[model samples]
Target: MKKIRIFIIDDHKLFVEGISSLLSDDPRFEIVGHALSGNELLSKFTELDLDIFLIDINMPEISGVELTRQIKKLNPKANILALTMYDDYSYVEKMIKSGAAGYVLKSANLSELSKAIEIVASGKKYFGEEIQEMVYNKISGKAAFDDKRPSMNELSLTKREIEILSLIVQEYTTQQIAEKLFISERTVETHRKNIFSKTKVKSAIGLSKFAFQHGIIDFK
Candidate 1:
């Protein structure tokens, strides 16, 4: 079996060592390298081949957000995952925009951490339940419209599009949404493409923000 090569970056040595020890035992993951700072990681960039990078958002210098942007510049295809204690929506948004494939709290269990690595390594996005909830709550509290209220007719979202947006806001994966709506996953993806085009957002996280801002989904 081919093992996924992993690199960890954080300011805390103990956290780095602990994660190294934990993942060293997992057959599916190979710890290729680790760094205590973004500068350290960049210095040895040419020396390591990594499939996934576990990054801490809060660092003394070159914060995870900036590091993620640099890493993407080094290798645009790199799969970056933010593993930190921060649950704030701004942090999550910034990290995602910086090219991170996933975000999970440091307090996450071994299973969730491993799952996040697998998901991101496979080119899929993963946001832990807690992170998702934090985003949902943050979006929910804001009014759907500002002084310039977009008329429903101007928004031009079809009924099916609205349904898919609601499911997306509820944190349903494309496959799950397909199953729930009794449609092919490809069809669901097509709808998502349309939704993004109509909303002018690039990611699911962006979609959630748009959904809340347009009152596409109700808070419960």
Candidate 2:
């Protein structure tokens, strides 16, 4: 069987090395590449035809949530599994909204990470038990996804912003977005910043969650 082609994006060198070592020994996975930030991952997008991406939630420059958005834009079919230490609902909600198939806490055993990778690679959702609890709590209305979710039209975003936000939810990077829309990288960044401000979101995950909760994209 062909090994699953996987890439990773995280800032912690020690963590990346440890995770890489763990994944290297697995016959089912192939480490295609790794990067320390969203910018680096975007720079190497063309070099990797990844079957899945293991993205950290927190990183310098751009967070994993934003990275997921950018990745989805480049390859809508890309399977993203957030690798993070956060088990809070905010993290779970944001990642899911950013088009991640699941969220895996860094504290999880190696077996758990493998399971998460396998599940996401197969196009299924796999939230760690601790994270699942938050998902459940949100669905049960014990906690809210966001305070004020705005509908796409009500958000007052330009048509281009809507188009870009849709792709961001799909994990498209700024470069991919530029190529897709025939715009410059700076233009894409400008639009993204505007989207963030208009949506009152601090990260890609927050905007994605707001978009989903507000029915901005009819994702099938």
Candidate 3:
């Protein structure tokens, strides 16, 4: 049985040490490394063979959104599982847009955390029940937040672009989208940028909103 190799990045030293110790007791997990900040993690990012990254959202210098984006750019195969105290729906949407595979609240028990890790490791997205409810509520427009409306460009989504748009909203990573669509990753990226431009919504969160507004994707 292969152990799930994990790398942790959190600003709190006590949390890092505690989680590392607790994870060490689990025979299925191997905590290969940890860092106290995003910069520190980037410095040693190339040094490890990690399966899942446990990232904290509110770091001092680089926020988890940017960190997760950078990590995905650095290692497209990197599977990020956000481990943060924040339960904000916006944060969850941002992290998913930034290429994180899952989101786990810091409040999660050992069993839930382990389950989240396993789900993400198997190439599926995971979110806590509470977080899921929050996202669903926001998407259904039961909750209020500013939705960045996209400019209705003269150009509209092509059939291919719509397909990609749906997959992107579903939180499929670029690589996975490429595989599923039977296209090159570069092609998938090009289509993604085109969708962004045509919809004039750069953020995936906003793009999903655009999709929902246009009936391209159902909010439900």
Candidate 4:
């Protein structure tokens, strides 16, 4: 199997070194290069052939979102994954919109971080559980949004379905939701299937986008 080549771009040297040391021993990954700023990365861009970019969203020079945009422009097939401390939905949304393949928090365990890298490298999206919860809370009005759009009634979602949807958006596993709601995991799965059908979304992120666009959840 070919090892995944990864580049780290973060202003924090300790963070960069920590990640490099963590992944350096893994036979599946190769740490190609790293940089302290977006401009630094761009300057050395042509020298590295990276399978994934682990980017910090809150950078001093260019934000990760903008760096993602520029990187995508430089190499449209670039697989970018955000590794950041920010849990704000605005940062998450911006990174996604800017063409990030995944978002993982700095607080994530090594296993989760490795899983995110592999998932994104395999052409899939990954959002850390905490990040998903952040998005869910923001969209569900746990964080205030000034938009007064009408409620999501056209879907005719039952109260139970809405409750389940919120939990799903919050990245709660079926087992976790079941345990929390005093229901069976199978029942939670059933609700999830129904929610998918009703919302016409195949993934949690898709459901999130639909929720934001359809006034089921608010952003801003």
Error of 1 at 24 (Å): 1.2
Backbone clashes for every candidate come to 0, 12, 0, 0
Which runs of model 3 end up more than 4 angstroms from their true locations? 143-220
Task: Say what the RMSD of model 4 is.
Answer: 14.4
Candidate 2 vs candidate 4, TM-score winner = 4
TM-score of 2: 0.62
- TM-scores for all candidates: the values are 0.64, 0.62, 0.64, 0.63
Candidate 2 per-residue lDDT, tens place, 167-193, comes to: 886677899999999999999999999
Which segments of model 1 are wrong by more than 4 Å?
Answer: 142-220
List candidate 2 segments past 4 Å from native: 138-220
Question: What lDDT is obtained when candidate 2 is compared to the true structure?
Answer: 0.79
With a 3 Å backbone cut-off (N, CA, C), the pairs that clash in candidate 3 are none
| lDDT for each residue of candidate 3 in 1-220, tens digit (9 for 90 to 100) | 9999989897765456656767788899999999888899999888889789989898878988999999999999888999876778889989999999999776555778889988887778899766786777888977743332333343366778878887877678999999999999999999988989877875776664455344344221
Between candidates 2 and 3, name the one with more favorable TM-score.
3
lDDT head-to-head 2 vs 4, winner:
4
Taken over the whole model, the C-alpha lDDT of each candidate is 0.81, 0.79, 0.79, 0.79
Cα displacement (angstroms), candidate 4, residue 57, comes to 1.3
Off by over 4 Å in 4: 143-220
What tens digits encode model 4's per-residue C-alpha lDDT throughout 73-174?
Answer: 999889999987666788889999999999987656677889999999988999987777777778787864333334447667877887887677556789
lDDT (10s digit) by residue, model 1, range 1-220: 9999999997765456656767878999999989989999999998888799999988867999999999999999999999886767899999999999999876556778899999999889999877776777778985322223245567888888888987876668899999999999999999999999999987665665565345444322
